[model samples]
Structures are given as C-alpha cells and as structure tokens.
Target: MDNKVPYSLPGMTESFLFHESQLIEVGLNNAQPEEVPPPAFVPPCISIDVSHLFTTDQIFPTRDDLINWVHGIAIENGYVVLITKSDSGGNGSRKAYVMLGCEKHGKYVPYRDPDLVEGTRTQKTECPFRLKGRPMKNGIDRDWRLKVMEGTHNHEPARSLIGHNFVGRLNSEEKEQVEKMSKSWVPPRKMLLTLKENNPLNLTTISQIYGACKRLRKSLRGSLTEMQHLLKKLDGDKYVHFERHEPGSEVIRDVFWAHPNAIKLFNTFPYVVIMDCTYKTNKYKIPLLEIVGLTSTDKTYSIAFCYIVNEGTDDYVWALECMKSLLADQAMLPKVIVTDRDLALLSAAKQSLPNTSHLLCLWHINKCVLAKCKLYVGTDDFAELVMGKWGEVVDAATVEEFEVQWMQLFNMCKDKYSNFTSYCSTTWLVHKEKFAKAWTNHVMHFGTTTSNRAEGAHASLKKMLRDCKGDLATSWDASHSLTCNQHTEILASFERSIHRIDHIFMFPFYTNIRGFVSNKCLQLIDDEHIRMKSYGGCDCLLRETHGLPCGCELAGHRSTTLLSINSICY
Candidate 1:
C-alpha cells in the first residue's frame, strides 16, 4: 500500500500547502522556522554617582533651598530628583523631613477603572536612587540637612533633560522675568534665550514659557470668563468700546474698540479713510475689521478695530456706525473711503457714509486682474503683456484717452484670451471711475491710489500679535501698545516738520515752507519741479486732485516759494 499523502485536501484544496508538503515528504525541505519573541530592553551599564553631593554637614537655609540644591545636583549628574513624601507640623511637636528619590524610583500602580481610559505606559523601573532631608539646628539658625539613602540607579543617566516636565519648569523669579518680557511682546524663543543666559542650568523650554503665560492669563482673569474680563479691561482703560448681542438673546455678536489717541488722530486727519478686514487674529476665528487714517506726513494710523462674528453687510454697517460715532462733528466725516472689492463693505460704506465718496483700491484691482489672467495664460511674459495694456487703460489722463485705451485692450485680448477679457469687463470695467486715473485724479484722494496703508497697518498689528490663538483681552493689549508707539512716532514727525528742515530742502523755492510743511510734501513738490524741468509742461493733475501745485503750475519762475504750508492739503 502507498503511504503517500494526497496532493491536496478535498474541500481545502486552495488552502493546502501542497508544494511545501511535497518538499518535506521528499526531505527537500525549507520548513517554517520557530517563532521568536521580541528582544527585551537592556539598561545601559554606565551609571551616575550623586551620593557624594548629599551629606549631613551640608545644611541648607530652608527645606525648599535644600530640595532645590539636591535637584540641581541630580540634574547635573544626568538624573532627576523628585519629592516622594514630606511631613509638616503646626507646632514643634513632630520632626519635619522630606523623602527625595529618583524620578523613576517606584513602579507605577495602575488604577483599574472602567470609566477612564488606561494611562500611557511608563518607563519606571523601581530605581534605587534615593535621598532624605530633615530640619537641623546650626548655631541659632534653623536649617535643613541632606542624607544619602541609596546611591545607585537601576537605569542609565539621561543624556538630556530638555523636555522633562518637572525638570523644565520655570522657578518663581524666572516666571516673573517671563511675565515682564511677555508684556513687551517678546517672542517665546527670545524668552528662552534670556532665561538660559540668566541661568546656565535652566532647562526651561519654549513650550514651558507658553504654559506659564497661559497660566498667568488664567490667573489674571480670576472668576470672570474671557469675554467678561475683556469688557472689564476695556472699561478700565477708558476705551471707546461697543458690543452687540444677538436680538432677543444674550450671545454676543460683535465688539468694537478705539483708543482715545486713535480717535484724536482720526479727528485730526479724517479726509481719506481706508477700511479692510483681517482674519485669524483671535481664538473665535472672527473677522477683524481695521479702519486706518492717513496723517499729514503720510503716516498711517489705526483708527478703530471691530471683531465681527460674520462678514455680512449688516455686520459691516454696524462696525461703520461705531466708527461714525467717533465723529463729534458731522462736517468732520471722511470725504473719501478706500477699500477692496468687498461688495458687503461697499454697500455698508454707501449706507453708512452716504455723502462720502467710495473709491476702490487700485492695488487690489490690479492684483485681481493679474491673478485671473495668470490662470488663463501659460507664460508670465504673456501675462505681463496683458497687464501692460491694462495699465494703459487705468492710467489714461482723460476720458477720451481711457476710452481709446480700453478699446485697444478689448481688441488685443478678445481673440486670444477671451476669459480674462470677459472677467475684466464684467467685474472691473464697471467700477472704472473708482480706480481709473481719469476719474480718480479728479477726486481729492490726497494722492492715495491703493489701500496699502491699511494693509501695512495690518501687517504691523499681526507682527506684534505673533499668535492667533490669543484671547480678546490679549489682542486688545497688543493693539493698545502698538497704538501708543505709533502716536509717539507721529508726534515726533510733527515736531520735525515744525522745527527741523533738511539740507535737501535748502532751495530758494522751498524757503517759506521749510519748517512748516512736511518733508513728504516738500519731496512731492521737488519731484514735480524736476519733472517739469526735464519733460516740459503737463496736465496740472496734482493741483486738482491733491490740492498741491503740479509741474505745470511750478514751471513759471523760481524767484520765491510758489506755495505756502496751508495751501498743501491732505
């Protein structure tokens, strides 16, 4: 009889290892190997010796000082010392002692709880390193003495303790230093460097600085919630604050604030106002609407800020109304408001400031035009060519020139890039008067063409506010400090314009306005003079738009100054 097994099982034919069995039966085997367990962790052989540092003769001024000194030595020797137990008495009835041990001294006891998830696994190995501290009397001085209980550890010394939670905490003094620097808006990395410089043994990390700051904020808030504390601080600071809640409910919908100095600056230079919204400035993810004003020296000042729950038209109208409340006199209302192509903002501006001229930001319009055209074209050269023609359309000096240039642009792109041409016609061409030089040059925009001033102000504010996860009160503090610094610079500029005159302006035509007009205005006049001298007479657009003498107006003679400080309008 043949004792050979069948090639496969009847039902489990696909599962049978026919080839393997055949090889095994014929002794041509490459059989399966036995399973092996994973390798166990082997502690490093090199151990740190810290027993000599702890002695009964080395007494500390207090228990805290003793613990701190012991921990410092342990950390220096590549290990951490933790307080395992302590005892205290109201009277001198019981002796006070503190049991110190290695961070990995004892085994972790797992708490069995069905409701709570299991804690993360630990590296505890019942380390044998231990020390003890007790109150000692030294010549009428109450001090503490340290004694070594066990000198050796079961595990290897730590190579670095940079992230150890207990080891990287900031002491009381360090925390105070961090608070002072944080109030100055210093970054976390710089805070860490300062700490390290102050104490070479400090293992504090940047994350620890952040935690301490968070705790400080929490403590400052006390019993109040973030919003309540914010309102309290705003009221305390005498800020012009406004808040709105959902109709028929207590949920807050929006908040607005303006510093007193900012209000004064707005009242002083309220001719041209620029408004825009920035995002990711607070924990609520609300949109922050910024209103910026231009000074006589061309410096941009933040007028107000609003945290709105939504970017809807009604929200913008409410914010605008809050700004309108700042105007003590109706005649001081802004004559021109510059903004991007946000239809909601545009409608709000029209509804809120009916008499104010709403002008579109030319920079934003050009950016949009370039971005949309880039999507249709394959090459940058072609895109730039289209932008060049588009520039001609916007820069035309007259309505006739604008019409002719617009026709040229339409004809050039109508055949090759229809999508871009159509986008411009539908989206931008309708709003030409707001951004085109032909119409904008006739309006008194103070020679402002874009919302770049507002954009720059946003940049500065965000830079001061390095993190977006801050609370409302934190945001307010940062902006308040920024406004104070801005006012200081503005006042300095005003002083310079009043008293100091640069040698560059030491010209016969600039004699009368030397110490009265701004350096920016003098520069403008000087540029116009150079242009008139180089290229002959041109359209006096500056006089009509900016209220300043143009190259054509200054082309006559150079006997004396042609303009006074009051003649130059903002």
Candidate 2:
C-alpha cells in the first residue's frame, strides 16, 4: 500500500490542495427539509353515461341508453362493466351487461365515451311518465290487485253486512233504505230494550222466565187434579152392578142375539153345519152345543159355539128346542147338516128345515159298523171294504141291489168276522142320495169319515176353560174373546183369498192352462199308488185300504187347480 500511494500522492497532492482549498469555504446548515406539499387532493372523477340503463319499455328511452346509463352508474360506484347477450332470448344482441370500476386497479379511471354522450338524447322515449311513476304506484297497485284477484270483497262485505243487522236496529235513513230495497218490511215504532237490560220482572232474566213457567205449570197441574177429582166423583156415581139379572135371562138374550148373526154368517157360504154335544161337570149338566161350518174356499172347518143349562126328562127335547131357536131363520139352513145320527137332532132338522139334507157322518156309520160287526168285520181290510161299499149301497138303483151287495159283503167276511148283513141293510142305509152325497163328499174327504171338527173344538174349549181353573164366567169371557179372534182370523183369510183370486186370475188362459197341467202332473207323480189306464177309470190305492180315495190327493189337486185358476182369473 505505501508503494502504490507515492504516485497518487504526488498527482493528487496538487489536485487535493486545490479542492481542499475550495471546499474550505463551504459551510454546513442543519435545516429540516421542507415537507413536499401533499399532492392536490383530487376527488375521484366519475363519469356516468346512465344511457340504456334499463329495458326499452321499462326505460324512458331506448334499451341501449338505459343499459349504458346503468353501466356507467355501476362504473362510478367502483364497478367494472362487462357487456354480454342475455341467453334467455338466444339473440346475439347485448341485452344485459355488468359494470367493473377503475378502482379495481387503484386508480380513478373516468370513462370518456363520446359516443354515449352524443347518442343519449336521440333515443326513443317509451313511457317517461310510467318510468317515473313506477316506484310510488307499484306497491299500492300490487296490493289492490291482490285483493281484487282473490275476490275478498265478495265474502267480507257480505259477512260485515250480516253482522251489522244482528247488532241492533239501523237509523231512520238506513231503515228507509233497507225498506226500499226489501220486498217486505215493517219496522217497530218503539225501540225495545233487551230483556236482560230491562230486568222487567225485577229478577235475573233466566230466573224470571223459569219462575213464570213454574207458576203456569203449577196452575195447570192444579186444574188437572181438580178435573180428575170431578171425574172420579162422577164415575163413582155412574158405577152400576151387573150381577142383578138372573143368569137364565142373560142366556136367553145372548142366544137370541147370536142366532141372527150366526144365521147371517151361515147364509153367505155353501156351508155344512156340524153339531155335537158334550156334558159339563155340573149339577145342571150344561149341554155344550157347537155349530161348525166348512169354508167352501179353503175347505177348512170353523165353529161357533154356545151352551144350554137344562136337565130333565125332556133334556133332549130342550136341546133340540135350543138348536131350533139357533136355526130359526130359513136362510140359516145349511145345505147339509151333519150329526152323529142322533135321533133328537135328526128330528129337530126334519121339523125346522125339512128341505135341508141330513147326513150321518160316515164316521158314525163306521162306528156303528164296527160295533155291529165285532164278530165279522175283524180285519181293517173288511172294515174298509164295508165302509167303501156303504156309499154305493146307499146309491143303489133299488133296495134289492143294496140288500144283495150287503149280504154278499157280510157273508164273505163271516168266516173271520161277525155277521153284519142285517145291520148294514137297515141302520146304515140312508136311501136319499143327497144325504149320502154329503157323507161321501164331506165326511169321507177326511180319512175315517168323522166330523172331528166339533169334537176337536170342544176339547180345545174345555182345555181353555180348564186352564182358567173352572171359573165359569172367566172361562166364558175368555172363550168369547177367543171365538172373536178366530172369526177375525177367518175373515182375514177370506179377504186374502179374495185378493189372491182377484190379482192372480186375470192372467192369460194359457198361463192358467199350464198351471193346471203342472198340477195334474204333480198329482200323478205324488199319487204313485194310484193306478190309471187308457180306457178303465183310475183306481185310487186309498180306496182299497181306506174305503175312499182318502180325498187328500183329490183335494190337493183340486185346490191347486182352483188356486191357480183363481190367481189367473184375478
């Protein structure tokens, strides 16, 4: 280092001496540097075009101006603007844009678009007034439109009007208006206060109404009690003893009154009157008489009954007299009268209605046969044979035929039976065909040929009376009521029959014809034991065993046909 500085010291000594001498005169001044005045505070210069800021229709001018104006306003507010076409319309036109500000780069970059300023005034004006009025009118209009669209006025006004009417009366003007609008109106002249407010009875309204009602009810109850007392007093005085009359007098009157009604009822039908007598357990030995009639429509038998209390040497005569009284009217005479071949009843019928036919029920005839032929008619076949021939013997052309057939039938059975030839010829033989016809038609229809209607009726009556413990009067009343009920039932059955006939019989003949054919077929099928031939008449199996066709098959067939015909005819 010492060697390197010798030349520089010689060369620089002179220069340094010159500079050092010049720098010796310069003085140091320690003064603060004047603060550079803050650069003039320039407010951010914002240029807003505000042209095309809104839609064409929505803006006061063209769409471009509205859009640009909106874009410029966005830029001034520190935003960047970017223009792009809206995809909704699929048009290339820039329908919408975004604004980006110059402050994005930390500088107040004011946009200088001369084209926007020049074109702002020339844009079309769509509706300047609408655009200006939108903010203020939109809220009010939207609320009003919602109410209108919802039809809120229709219901609310109606409810409010109804509520007003319920509250109180309207003023004079309002009342007059309502009257003018209504078809009928009458207003009260005086305004009445509510019952609760008026307190008319000086009590709570509910208590007052209740008390008034109670008082009214008490008065009504008192009136009813007085009326009842008066009625009781009257009834007590009016009560009469029904026991004062002699029993015989009452019986006479009842018999007289019942006779006419019985006669009337009997005359209405082609009825067979059946009579029977039973002895009651009494000192008087009351002869219970029952009159039965066969319904021509249904063939069902019914009974009307009464009793006579008399016992003496002439008891049969008294009974006959009572029967005669019961059948006093000629119209009451039944077409056929059936009895047990009682001499007394036969004599009474001969006396009362000489024209009326009297038949010994085949039942009585058979009983007589059995009693007489105890030695001969031993077997049921012989008994049935005898009973079967009874009708034919009665209908014989001459007495000799009947005698011949009777003797033959008797002799054939004599080996194992009693000889009943004479008995069959005499007592059982009624020469009158009409009388025999009655036995054949009515009695024989039921197996065994018995008029069990009267016997059955008597048994029922006795049971009913017995159940009452032999209280004569109670039994009599109960029997009377029972008889009435029976009559009512019979009447109902008759009415129903009438209705069925009327309703069913009015159909076409072919329908009825078919029904008749069907019934015949059914009968043929049901009566399988009955043998039929093309030429010879059919022989009912029942005839050989029961002495008759048993009439069941015949009756069923006939009833079915009749009912069918009735239905069709009606």
Candidate 3:
C-alpha cells in the first residue's frame, strides 16, 4: 500500500526514494505561500515629543511671548495652536494664565435655523491638545513660563498648514507689502509669490490676499461709498468728470470723465473719432464706453471713458453729450465718427453731433457676417467660399459694382442657402451705406473705417488694470497713468515730425512740406509717387477720401519744384 520506488538523476549527487504521499505533499506546498509583511511603522500623531521643546525652565519676557513661542513650535510641526482662554487677573484675584489648544479642538453643536434651507458644516474634531502659559512664580517682572497640559491630539497632524485661516493671516510687514503692491495693481498670485520668496514659511493664500485688498480699498474709501470715492478721486485729480443722477434720487445713472490733455488732443485732431463699449473691466458689470481719436502723426489717443447704466438710447445720448462738451467749438466736432452698428449709439451720435457723419466699422460687420453664415452653411469649404464672395461685395469700388456683386452672391447661394441670403438681405444690406467701401470712400475718414483704434485702447487699458474686478477709482488711476505716458509719446512724435526727415523724402517735390508736415504725410506722398511709376493711372480715391493727392495728382505736381504744406489735409 506504500507504493514507494527509488529514483536516480544524472546531475544528482544522491538518489532518493519517492512515494505517492510525498509527491502529494510537495504539490500541496508548490511555492511557499507569499509571506504577508507587517504594516509600516507609523510614528505617533505627534511625531516628536515636542512637549520636550516646551520647557518649564524657560521664562518668556511676557505672556504673549510665551504663547507665540509655543504656537510657532506647533506651526512648524504642521498644526495651528491658538489661544483658547486667557485670564488677565487685573484685580490680582488669581495669577494670570493663558490656555492654548488646536484650532480644530472643539465639538460641533447642531444649530439649525428653521427658516434656512440648509445647515452649515464645521471643522471641529474634539481634539484634546492643550498648553498653558502663566506668570512666573515671582510675578514681579511680568515674565511668563510655559507648561504642557495635554500633549496629544485626537487627530492626525496636517501634512501642510496652507489654507489654514490662522496660518494664512499676513503679518504687519507683509500687509504693508500687499497694500503697496495692490495699489500698483500687482496681481494676488504675484503678491503671494513675492511674500513666499521673502519668507519661505509664509502660508498666505490668494483668498486672504483678496480679502486684504478688499479691506484696504474699503479703508481708503473713508466715509464715502465706492461711487462717492470715485467721484472724489476724479475731482481731486482734476479730471473733467460729469455725472447724471436719477430724476428724484441722488443715485448716479451715467458718469463720464476725460483728462485735460485728452480734451486738448481732441481739439487738436477732431477729424476722426471712434467709440466702442468694452465689458468685464469693473465689478459693477456695467459697460465702459471708450472713445479714441487719431493724431496727425498717426497715433491713437484715448479721448474719454464713460460708465453707462445701460446701452440704451438715453444712456448713449448722455455719453455723447459729455463728449461734445469737450469740443473747443461746436464747429470743431469730429467730421467722421466710426462705431459698430449699435443702433442706440448710432442714433445717439446723430442726435448729439448732427453734423458728424456716422460710419459702421467694416471689420466688425465682416466678422459677424462670417460667424453667422458659417453656422448656416454645412461644410467649411462652402463657408470659406461664401466669405470670399461676401468680401467681394463689401469691397466693391462703386455703387453700381456693389449692387452687381451682391446680385451675383445671392444668385449663387440663394437656392441652397436661403437662410444665409435672407439674413444678408435683411440685416446687412439695409445698412450697406454705413460700411461698404463704395459709400464710405466718399467721406474724409482719413482711411480709418473701423473701430480698431478703440479696440486697441481697450486692450492697453485692460493690460494696465490686470484684473476686471477693480473699482471705478482704480480704473481711473490706471487710465490716468496711461494717458500721461501716451501724451509723452505724442509730444516726442510731434518733435520728430518737426525735426526729423527720412532720407527718401529729400526730393524737391517734398521740399516745402517736408519739415512742416508729419513724416507720415511725406511717406504717403512718397508711396503715391512710386504708385504713379508702377501704374499708369490712379482712381483718385485718396483725393476724395483723405484729401491727399493720389498718384495722378503726384504726376501733375512733378512740374512744380516744391509743393506747399497746405496741400496736405489734417
């Protein structure tokens, strides 16, 4: 019954006997069952016996000093220890002592309000961590000594103390840095980085920085409200500020302001101006109307900014009226006012400056048309074709040509894209005269047919602001700084226009107007001269649109030794 046999192998040093029972035992124990290692050696919640760090032999100069020393040790070990209780003992009834414990040491009691829909959460863990600081035995020098009461916590210590309200609070020096950096418009993140770079132990958070900034702004406001502070700052800074209040209330409806130099620039170059509304530049959620003008040296300058209650006709009228008030003379109103097709602003412009011609920004119209028609078309290829054709219609050089191009576009796309053609017919075709080059070319717009200038000014202003949630006073401060820098550049440009001339502009044809006109003007004349040589004729669009001589005029002027500066139009 044993069933045993003797076996031998070539590489074996000894022979062994095999049995059915032995083989079964070997199979059962094939690979020794993997050993389960014991769990990791976890240190206690309080890794080090920091109680040894707090010594009764050490005496602090004051009670606050003792508390600070203990708290600092707790913070280093990744926990916040705050004062739980303190006995001043002013009447000397008992010795003065302060109790400190973990910030998360209390028990949460349910305090639900019947009127409220939800209950709030709490972070209390009923931790039993505690320390005590009391006056020294002598009690004559006001010195204090520290003693550990409960050295253990019921919970694990934090791995890091960031975002802890107590740890995130800024100290006095850090608060001063934040206040200064905020006025300079340094972003909160940057402020945090700077603080950390100065002190690696700083645990300040962005929310805390924001809270500090809010408090600082509120304090700066003194007894005045946000709007009142804005008005006061504007007045103190000598800005030309105008505000319209509600009929029977003191609440402001619309407010406008312009710098003194801005008004002067407008009076100097009142030929072309552009207005547009930008959003998300303030906390009020109100639209900011940005008005800009062009200089003779081809620079864009911000003329004014308005915070309107709404983009309604009445609001726009008030803003435009404020703009009109900056004119040196009623006759000196801008000859051309470029804006997007905001119907309210368009009508307001007409009412405020009746003599000024209002033209729609062609770029905005084209952008809108492309975005809308692309959605209607099925494929990207067809969408591109539609835009190409639309561009032709927009760029038609004459009224007759514009009509012809439009007809071609409709016939090509009408059957399959009826929605596209209908939208064009109703929305854009009715306002063709405002944006189409065929009509816009007839006006002296000085080649500015879009509101890109105002867009650029907005981009620059917002870059300086950095944050959209700034108050009106902060926005005005940024704008004031921008205006000062812009005026400096403009002055330097004027000086160059009078003193500097390019080598290409030394020809006799530019002799008389070379120094009197801007280098930009001479460059335009030079360009025209080249065009006359390249092309045999010119359409004279420049002569009509910008009041500058075209290539054809340049050819006739070749007979004259010198051209007069009067030939160049402002």
Worst lDDT run of 10 residues, candidate 1, spans 559-568
Instruction: Tell how far residue 161 is off in model 3, in angstroms.
Output: 2.1
Off by over 4 Å in 1: 1-61, 109-123, 136-143, 380-383, 555-570
Return the clash pairs for model 1, or none. none
lDDT of each: 0.83, 0.41, 0.82
RMSD of each: 5.2, 43.0, 11.9
TM-score for predicted model 3 compared with the true structure = 0.80
Q: Estimate each model's TM-score.
A: 0.87, 0.39, 0.80
Q: Which stretches of candidate 2 lie over 4 Å from their true place?
A: 1-264, 281-284, 299-304, 309-332, 375-404, 413-419, 430-450, 467-471, 501-507, 510-570
Residues 1-570 of candidate 2 have per-residue lDDT tens digits of 222223345446644442332333442224344558558345344333332432233332333454455444433433333332212212423222222222122323334874555434321111111111121123222111000011111011112211121122233444333333221211111112233244332212233333333343344336444324323332443321111123557323112113233444454543366777765622334465666665423333334444444422234344434444444365654555667777766776777657666666665665666666555565577577765665565545444665666667767656654456655656655433433432343322222234677777667666544332232333343345445555666666556554433323334422333333223223332353234322334434344322223233444243333342222112
Cα shift from native, residue 170, model 3 (Å): 1.9
Lowest lDDT sum, 10 consecutive residues, model 3, at 559-568
Best by TM-score: 1
Candidate 1 lDDT over 320-389, as tens digits, reads 8899899887788998999999999989988999998889999889988888888876457877788899
